[model samples]
Target chain A: MEILVAAILTIITAATPLLFAALGELVTEKSGVLNLGVEGMMVMGAIVGFAAVHYSGSATVAIFASMLAGASMAAIFGVLVLVFHASQVPTGLALTIFGIGLSALVGQSMIGVAYDGIPQLHIPVISDIPVIGEIFFSQDGLVYLSIFMVFAVMWFMNKTRAGLILRAVGDSHDAAHAMGYSVLKIRFLAVLFGGAMAGVGGAYLSLAYSPLWVEQMTAGRGWIALALVVFASWKVRRVLLGAYLFGGISILQLHAQALGIAVPSQVMSMLPYLATILVLVIISRDRSKIKLNAPASLGKPFHASR
Target chain B: MLPRLIKRQSPSKAMVYLSPILALLLTLLASIVLFLIMGVSPSGALHAFFVEPISSIYGLTELMVKATPLILIGVALSLGFRAGVWNIGAEGQLILGGLFGGATALFFYEKTGFYIIPLILIMGALGGIIWAGIVAFLKTRFNANEILTSLMLSYVAALLLNLLIHGPLKDPDGFNFPESRLFSDSALLPILYDGTRLHLGAVIALFFVGIGWILLSRTLLGYQIKVMGDAPAAGEHAGFSHSKIIWTTLLISGGAAGLAGAIEVSGPIGQLLPNISPGYGFAAIIVAYVGRLHPLGVLFAALLLALSYLGGETAQMKLNLPVAVTGVFQGLLLFFLLACDVLIQYKIRTSKKSESTIAPAVKSSIKSTSEVK
Candidate 1:
């Protein structure tokens, strides 16, 4: 029972970052933009968050700083893809490449540096219960925030007028334009939100999860988040479930390594990635399911014509 | 008074070729600023980066040695990109090729045979084909996105490389190093230059570029690839199988990437290390885009990018700049190029009046292209 609780806790920690990133990307894609720079944004957030925490000695300051850093990175992507009419696929890749270089250069001194993990929310009386209390009441505020975002995003997408407008823009930019919607403006904001979310997800890695700075620390979680959005078929609720599923696979490998299994560590490391490929194959096998929910203008560049 | 982007009725042919040069110039300007910001003398740093790397014949040979894998991978990726197949697993395929190529070398450990080099090269390409084959199969059979599958497979490939080196191919005489035993003389690529690392692989890469150019510009297969990319429905109307194009391009690109990997290990490094690649596969994507997805353009882009690798090393040695600058430069170049591509389809104008006239013309052109299907 103790082992089970511990494993579940680790899975929550692992899944929270993906959830944040995928949710942000989900909003962006729903607005008809595909920002592949999530990995880049996440790594930048991780490094900047680590640096801000080290210097300011405040987790709140660090979180905001990381969000700003991520937003700035997304802004670069937006200007190119949205304003300049660049190809989304290559532009997103460029953003990632630039982010990686910039992050590594900036965090040169902070490599291998460690800090205290983010403080958990300690709710009085609620913390005294069994496994449920430890899992639900004791997690860091950001974990709860990640979960809260799922509900918030779901509510916003289905219940709000703005959400419908965003979806309409994604469905057909020309039709949406005829209806008086600004596709570029909507997509630009969505991209920024996605960037900020990816940044916070990255921050969770550096400030809360491992509480240290390392180059490429996000280590393909950004890419996994990208896959998660696709595997979820752009559904907010499915993004949450997919994040936990991937998180579970990741922690399972860690546990296997700790158990002194006969398998090599590298072999164990292949589990999450292989599982990603496997899950992608399974999810994509149903063409109708993907086509049903996928944003029509997901990757197409919108050229506004008066 | 506001600048409205006026759509071009047809894409500017001049911009298609000219934008890369414009991007390269912009990157230079950006790099100069970057170096100045780093507090290094811009001229000295630039010279150290661009001129010093190939000032000597020996340096020129090393340039080709470095450009070998890039050109090979770039040309293959160009083929796939043109055909609308995003095979992002070239890095993984390269690693797998090295593993199999190195395995062949180790199998003939201490035996010298004239057939060894060709055998290793063939096996290396076959390894890449098999790895990329998984991506192709999943894409065809399961309708999976090759982008995600291939990328995920890359991480799996990296882990597999570590597993192979640490356990299955660990050098016996070496003090527990996670690497394979050195290849025999016959297993190694024949040297093409004296006092340099230039080998048979460099020649092969150049040859592949020529072959790629001819195949792309003058063949029925090339026409099918172009059709498949621009209009898939037209490809179907023309009775060309969509799955066939995917498998063919993937196998070709995967095969080429594998050849480059085997060559890197056999030519320069001379043995399989725990990690043989320094992200050559990913860098080749930059090369493909910079080259405008043309085989000949890839040749030039490969040389320039290879020079950046040399420049980064020189910068670290002389200017005390971080080697990460190479990646930054490549990223910036791609960004600038993408931004410049806007000029190909649109022009900035001060009047909304011109946009009114051009917008419908551009829209009609777009419609007409689709009408070809």
Candidate 2:
């Protein structure tokens, strides 16, 4: 019972960052831009958020500052790929490298500093329940926000007019331009949202998950989040499921080590990445199914020559 | 006000020469800004970054040592990229090559014969070729995106290395550190000079660069690669098999990357450890591009990038600067290069509603109509 409870709790915590990141990436990809700089952005968020809380002694400010920083970085990427018409792949890679370097350079001083993170909030009746309450209703505010954001993104992408325009732009930028929609404007907004969400995810690491800043604290979570987007098939709800599943795998590796499992840690560490690759290969095997839902102008630069 | 229009042009001879130099100048400017933000004097930091590394013998040796793998990998990456094949998994290939070659060397530790080193080198190159062959096969057979697949496979390769070093390949007598047994003197790469850590790998790297240059400029295969990259349909019409090119490019590149990895373990490191690579595979991608994906250009670019790695360490110890500054410079250089490349392809033209615009506009409209048809 205790192990099950612990696993469930671990899943939620692990899922939070991935959820935030994948949701952000979904928005970016939906706008026909693939930003591969999530890892870099997340690291910057981790450092800035840690610095904010460490200096100001406030979690709110740290989280807010992280989002701003992330959004700003994303904006630079948006300008390069959207306005300057740079190749999306190389630009995205450059953004990531820039982010990683900037974060490491800035984060050197804040090593070992701990922040007082946001505390858990529990509902009255739900808090009193046994296992269900402990698992579901007792997470910190950010975890709840991540779950809410997932549903919010689903609704925003499906039921809203802005969502429709965003989808139309992603499906076919030329058609969207022909229909008098501002493809660049919609893409800019989507990219900004993605950047901000990625920032929040980074903040979750420093402000809540680890409560400390470490160089490359996001590790390869950004890459995992990128993989999760493909695994989710670009659906909002499925992103949540994929994130939690990846989170579970990550946590399982940690717990296995703690329990003195005989399996090599390196092999175990490869589980999440290997699983993601396997999922990609399987999904990509039948190209037609993927083509059905894939964004038509995904990763291609759109230039209006009117 | 009228929006400025730009006329696209074929790349000129002068611009081709100027692009990299301009990119470097922009990178330096960006680095100065970065140094200012980090509270270091720009000139002093730049000196520490570039000049100081080549000043002392120790630093020079370190630069050469670092450049060995970079030169090898950069050459390999240039070959594939010139043919328009993006092999982003060189890091993984490098790791696998190191593991295989290192294992072979260790296995033959007792048999200190004349042929041991040669055998290990061959095995290392073979290891890299096999690893790259996986991506090549998938790409040719299923039309899978090599960029994503190659990159993802690198993670698998890394994990396999980690598993080996920590588990089965762990040095038996050593304390709990995750590393393989140190290679014997017979297994190790011989030093080139009397005092420095620089070894035969440097010579090997130069030899490969020469070979790469010859193959790219003079061979029929090289022409096929260029044509394939420039116009895939035209190459197909010219009777070049896309699958064959894919296999050839990946195998050659992968073998080069693998050879570098093997040399790395045998040379400076002398042992297999958990974190063997400092992202040499990925960094070589930048070096390849900065070199314009040309074999000889890759040599110079590799040295410049190698200097950054050496300088990054110097800054870390002397100025208390973060090592990530190296990565920042690399990223900045790539960004500036892309910007410069745009200028190379397109000439900015400003007009005030004049006669010149009418002719170009009419031509563009005609081209657009034909393109639509």
Candidate 3:
């Protein structure tokens, strides 16, 4: 029972960053922009957040700083893709490359600096319950925020009029433009929001999940989060499901050793990536489904008739 | 007034060539500001970053050595990018190639033969193909997204390289080091330059560039690739098989990346280690773009980017700057390249009246293209 709870906590810790990134990207894609720089943005956020905490000794400052760092990175991407009408795919790739490098340069001194992990949330009465309270209520503030975001995003994407407009822009930017909605404005904001979310996700890594700075430490989690968005088929609920599922798979490397599994650690580490490919293959095999759900203008450059 | 983009009657053919040059200039300008912000003297930093590295004859040869893999990979990636098949896993493919080629060298373990080097090179490419083949199969058969699959496989490939280095490939004579034994001279690539580290891979890279140029400019497959990228439906209607293009481009890229990996181990490093490349695969994407996705362009771009690698090392030693600055420069260059590419499609005008005059002409052209589609 103790082991299960411990594993569950590990899963939550692992899942939070992916959740934050994928959720942000989901909204961005819903608004008809494909920002492949999630990894870059997240890494930038990780360093900036780590540095913010190191200097300020405050989690709030760290989180906000990371968001600004990520949003700034996204703004570069936004200008290139939205304003200059550059190809979204390569521009996003460039953004990722730029973000990773900038983050490394910024975090040069912060390497090896450690911090006490972010404090967990506590409520007076609900926290006293056994396994349920421990599992549900004992997570850090960001974890709760992630859960709230899942619902908030679901509500925003589904029930809101703005969400409908965002979807319409994604489905047909020309139609949305004809309707007098600003496609670039919506996409640019969506991209910035995505960057901020990716930033918070990075903050979760440095501030909560290992609480230290490392170059390229986000590793391929940014890429995995990207795959998760595709696996979710742009649905918010599925994004939560996919993030946790990937998170669980990611923790398998740790648990495998504890369970005395004979596999090499390197091989164990390959599972999440390999599983990403497998899940992508499974989810993407249904072409009609993807075509039905994917935003019509997802990655296409929007050239407004001025 | 904010300058408005006036759509060109047609894409500027000259701007296609000019954009990369403009981008390079802009990157240099940005680097000056970056160095200033970092509290380093911009002139000294730029000198150390670019000019100092290639000042000597040996440094020039070393630049070629670094560029060989980039040229090989960049050429292949350019081809793939033209076809809209994003194979971003060249890093994994390169690693697998090294592993395969290195394993072959290990298998022979001191055998002397003229054929050994060629065999090792073939095995290297085969290794890359086998890795990228997984991506191709998943993409073609399962309808999986190539971008994510290829990238995911790269991580898997890296771990696979680590696992091998720690286990089966570990040198028996060395003290538990996570690396393979030094390859025999017979397994190594022949040196091209008499006094420097320049190897046969540089020549091979040049040879492939020529072939890539010829294939791209002079073949039906090239035309098919262009049509497929520009309009997939049109390509299909023209009876070009989409799957075939995907397979051809991927295999070509995978093979090229693998060959580069093999050459690295055989030519300069002469042994296998956990990290054989400094993100050469990823960097080649920038090379392909900045080179304008043309074979001849990729060759020059590869050399320029290769200088960045050397400059990073020099800057680390001289300016006390972090080596991450190289990556920052590469990324910035690509960003500037993409931004500059805007000139190819549109003309910028500051005059407010120009928008009204140009809008109708551009709208009609846009409508015609949509109608054709």
For DockQ, the strongest prediction is 3
lDDT string for model 2 (B1-373, tens) is 5445354556666766687889999999989998898789999899888888889887788888898888999988888887788887899899888988899888986678878888888888998999999889877765566776787778889889888887778999879788888999898899998788989999999999999989888999989999998899999999998889899999988998899889988889898998787888888988888888888888899999999899888877877787888988888887787667665555555556544656787979988999999
Q: List interface RMSDs for the candidates, in order.
A: 0.9, 1.8, 0.6
Give model 2's TM-score versus the native structure: 0.92
Q: TM-score (0 to 1) of chain B, per candidate?
A: 0.93, 0.93, 0.95
Candidate 3, residue A128: how far the Cα is off, in Å: 4.5
Task: Kindly list the per-residue Cα lDDT of model 3 for residues A1-306, writing each as its tens digit.
Answer: 877888899899999999999999999999999999999999999999999989998888888999998899989999999999899889988988888899899989998887998888888789768789899888888999999999999999999999999999999999999999999999999999999999999889999999999999898888999999999999999999999998898668878877778999999899999999999999999999999999999998898865
Writing each residue's lDDT as its tens digit, candidate 2 over A1-306 gives 777888788888888999999999998999899988888788888888889888888778888999988898898888877766767777777777788878877888888775667778779999768898898888898898998998899999999999989998999999999999999999999999988889889889988888888877886788878878877889898899999988888776878866668787777777876777666666667778778777888997787666
TM-score of chain A of each: 0.97, 0.96, 0.98
The regions of model 3 sitting more than 4 angstroms off are A124-128, B352-373
Please tell me which model should have the higher DockQ, number 1 or number 3. 3
True contacts kept of each: 0.80, 0.53, 0.88
Clashing residue pairs in candidate 3 are none
In model 2, the Cα lDDT at residue A82 comes to: 77
Ranking by lDDT: 3, 1, 2
Provide the DockQ value for model 1.
Answer: 0.81
What ranking of all candidate models by DockQ puts the best one first?
Answer: 3, 1, 2
Write candidate 1's Cα lDDT for B135-185 as tens digits: 999999999889878888888888888888888788898799988888889
RMSD per prediction, one decimal?
A: 5.0, 4.4, 4.4
Label model 1 with its docking quality class: high
